[model samples]
Target chain A: MLNIKNLKVSVENKLILNDLNLKINPGEVHAIMGPNGSGKSTLANVLSGKKGYEIQGEILFDELNINDISVEERAQKGIFLAFQYPVEIPGVNTNVFLRTSLNSIRKSKGEKELDTLTFLKLIKEKAKELGIDEKFLSRQLNVGFSGGEKKKNEILQMKLLQPKLSILDETDSGLDIDALKIVADGVNSYKKKDNAFLIITHYQRLLDYIKPDFIHVLSKGKIVKTGSAELALELEKSGYKNL
Target chain B: MKNQNLNINQEYKYGFTTDIESIKAPKGLSEESIKFISNIKKEPSWMLDWRLKAFKRLKTLKEPNWQKPKYPKIDYQDLYYYSAPKSSSNKPKSLDEIDPKIIETYKKLGIPLVEQQRLNGIAVDAVFDSVSVATTFKEELTKKGIIFCSISEAIQKHPELVKKYIGSVIPLSDHYFATLNSAVFTDGSFVYIPPNTRCPMELSTYFRINASETGQFERTLIIADKGSYVSYLEGCTAPMRDENQLHAANVELIALDDAEIKYSTVQNWYPGDKDGVGGIYNFVTKRGICKGKNSKISWTQVETGSAITWKYPSCILQGDNSVGEFYSIAITNNHQKADTGTKMIHLGKNTKSKIISKGISAGFADNTYRGLVDINEKATNSRNYTQCDSLLMGNKCGAHTVPYIKNKNSTSTIEHEATTTKINEEQLYYCNQRGLDQEEAVSLIVNGFCKEVLQQLPMEFAVEAQKLVAISLEGSVG
Candidate 1:
């Protein structure tokens, strides 16, 4: 469902990522593990079409080149990136933002949008699944939410969008045990045969819940080694020195 | 790159002129010019005397240079004091007899003058150039003992009421532009709500400056009697002109004992071309006085046009326990200059006032909020709260806030808060990633910034005001 070959990214005269290649087919969950400054976040940002980057080479998703597509266009074409740090947009209600985002994608797909009542019901059921019961949908988007709550909100957006390829960028970094469990449950329920997931993280705690078919260690903007789920646990015990 | 992103390219939408014959007063402002305006209105001798007295007082006053917005040399002698459509020479007794071309002009401007097609429960008095052409729902208003008509007609038909309150709130020697308006004012609306009665419908007036080489001086006076309540709204839009036109208007509102008066205005005069060559110079003076105990007065305005604007709608809280409030949203884009705010002078014991102002400056425009809160010595236990916020877009624009506070009585409290923020690229990127284009993203952010002031506007106008806020800040996102 997603492929990247010879991806090079730079920002403001500084080269961050160089000669990166990866491939993930349908129904596959791939984990990209890397240390700090290893181009993990840069790859996520480049995939989401964040500006201020000097990019070169091919970034194909679903057999379509996404290097030149705008951020919203990529999202409309079933590509979603859950940010490590969600931007706080005050005065925009959470529910309103989610509804607009989903409806925009639905409209591009030639599907009818849910009205106010239907949207409210859908959002409530989704929130109930995420264990968010306290009227957080009406508040401004991530204005003053706690760390765990913000991560849960990201998962909520991913569930609603139902993207073909979802990039979870450090989704388990700031979460507690309860929040981590709920997030894993939410992701596990949404996993299907025609969809794929790219989990970017540094720890093996998240790997215990959502198992990946293959794990790749990213070092100096290139994959140094590829293995199975045991690779994550081994890296957790012995660190990156052996890789 | 930033300059290209911040260049606003929206052309003036209401720039066409209607070809209508106009009866114009001779150029210049002298005793004779004032007399010419009064004679054209066919006023009584006392009204003529009032204008001559105002003109005599105006000679001693100089053009006010105290405002922040700069004004070029105004050629008073070259300005025509009065110009009305020639079709209304006989004063068209009915709306049907009025010129269809004039009605069509208003229809094109999005203001329906015909009562049946109008926004139900609201009346409109349209002023074309310098004279009031038609006032809708006149019969319905009069049946409730509410007198709403042209100020000129009030002088001829209801002389006693007009004479009693003509200069009651704002005297002839109030200021420079007000003195000019009092001397040569042509037409405006006059409203009087009877004692112990609430006005049934929302009263409104639409002012248009169509004729060129003319000055529009409107004088509106509203009086809410004892135990009465009234909500009045006024909206103005002007056609494009090559030379700058002067609009010096005077509005006075009086609330008696146990009465409440709400005055709202949405002003959209032409703001010149992108380079600021031709537009309106809006110098207006609006004041309301609470004369009796327990009376209230409120002023809400959204000003989005004019090359230079200098206005301060104020309230004098004279009666004990009286309250005053002011909410304003002002936007200046592409060389437009606006210096607007309000004043609350507390002269009564236990009186309270609150003010909220939002100013947005984009392009090379300059926007300032200058407000005054004065608590008199005898105003024991009085209170006032003021909040002024300015939002700037792009590096070329500017926003400033200057607040004056005075509390003579030891027991009184005056609190003031001011903040200035720029529309950063971070906010825009966040919105853009959410599937909104630059224009829609800027509009959404600006609307959120001005939500406090927009909430104070009436429902019908709130929608239009939100759209105006978006359209005004079109390319200010560098």
Candidate 2:
């Protein structure tokens, strides 16, 4: 469902992602483990079509070269990226933003839009499953939210959008153990046979719950090794020094 | 893309005028013309004497040079002082009896005088040129002890009240335009709310300029007695003309002890074309005075259309514990220029004032926010806060702020903050990424910029103003 061939990306004349290649199919979960300055976040940003990036090489999504598509178009094509730091959009209620984003995606997919009642019901159900307080949805998006709460919000957006390819960039960085479990469980619950995920992390603890099907080691803007779920544990035991 | 062509002639919507013969004074400003206007209205001797005094004062007063607009020297002697459509000797008893041409002019301006089911509840006093056509809801307001009528009628029916407070707040020699307005002004709305009486409905006055080569000089006065409250709204529009037209109006308000007066203006004069060919020169003076303890006064304006607008609606906080506020959103697009703001004078102890101004400049337009906050020596513990922000859409346009804060009292506190920013390229990119076109993105960002001031309007007007902001910014983006 996703393919990156020798993806080279630069921002402001600084090469951030150089000759990076990766691939993932439907119904599979892949974890990319890298240390600081390993271009993990840069790869995620390039895939989401963020501006100020100069790219060379091809990025194909479902057999279409999507390097020129806008971020919103990528989102409508079932591509979601949970930000490392969620932006605070004051005066825009979370529920309204979610509903707008949801309806926008649905309209792009030629699906009927949900009215207020059905939208509320859907939000309530997702809030219950994610253990999120219902009141948070009515407040401004990401405003005054704690680190863990913002991570949970990203997961909430993923659940509502139901993107086919979800990329979690450093989603578990600042979360406590209990928060990690809640966020990991939120991701685990959304696993389906027709969707894929690329989970990027520096710690092996989140992998204990998510259980990736394949593991790739990234360093210096390139994938150095490809292994299975056990590879995350090996890195935890020996650290990236041995790799 | 198909909707782009629909707005090609959008500026021409207000370009047509009704064809009617008018009784016009010879083009010029002189003592004779002022006397002619007073005699035509059949004013009392004292009124004529007052007009003569104002006419002399206007001669010595030089045209103001503080506003941020440039134009050919105004030929005061080249303008017709009084131009009114000839009507029957008897006043029209109902809307149907009014001339159809007058009604059609109002209809084109979206303010039809002929009452429809939707307009049954709204009280409208439609003013054309120098006379009031019809005043609806007069009986209802009269039952509530409210006197809402034309200034000419008020001069005859309630001369004592008019004499007591005609130029009490803004004197005849306040400014060049005010002096000119005092000299040859024909008619406008006169509202008087008795003590402790709350007006039952909103009072509105619509001004339209129709005659060619005629300058509209109207005067509006509103007085809220002690412990009374009232809200007044004013709107203006004019047909397009190849030559620039002059409009100089003066509006004054007086609020006594514990009285509150809310005045709002939505000025949409005919802004010139893209090349800045011909439009209206809107120069006006509006001021309110808090004369008694604990009085409150606020001025809110949304200025979207004008070729060159030079006005500053101000307030004077004279009584102890009085409050004054000014909330303004001024947009200048396509060769429009606006130099507008407010003045708050703190004279009494513990008085407070606030000013929030938002200016948007686009399409080679120049918009300026010039304001003053003065605290007198006797105003102990007085406080003032001002926030002025400007947003520039394109590089060719200009936005500037000139604030003067003068405090004579050591115990008074005044805070002034101003910011000039261009539209966020990233925010625009984000909205465009979400499938909104460039114009929609610009509108959304502009709305967010003016959100602080727009929220101060009444609920229904807030919505309408938001839509107006969008319409004004249409085609502004390249």
RMSD per prediction, one decimal?
A: 2.8, 3.9
Model number 1 iRMSD: 4.2
Candidate 1, superposed: residue stretches over 4 Å from native: A95-131, A192-195, B1-8
* CAPRI quality level assigned to candidate 2 from its DockQ score: incorrect
C-alpha positional error of residue B258 in candidate 2 after TM-score superposition, expressed in Å:
0.9
lDDT of 1 by residue, A1-243 (tens): 788989889888788888888998988999999888888988888887878898988999889888887776777787788778787776667887788777767876789988888999998999998888749999888889988888888889888888888889999998889989988988898899999999999888999999999998988887899999999989998998776
Q: For model 2, what is the C-alpha lDDT against the true structure?
A: 0.84
Clash-forming residue pairs, model 1: none
Q: Which candidate comes out best when scored by lDDT?
A: 1
The lDDT of each candidate is 0.87, 0.84
Chain A TM-score of each model, in the order shown? 0.97, 0.98
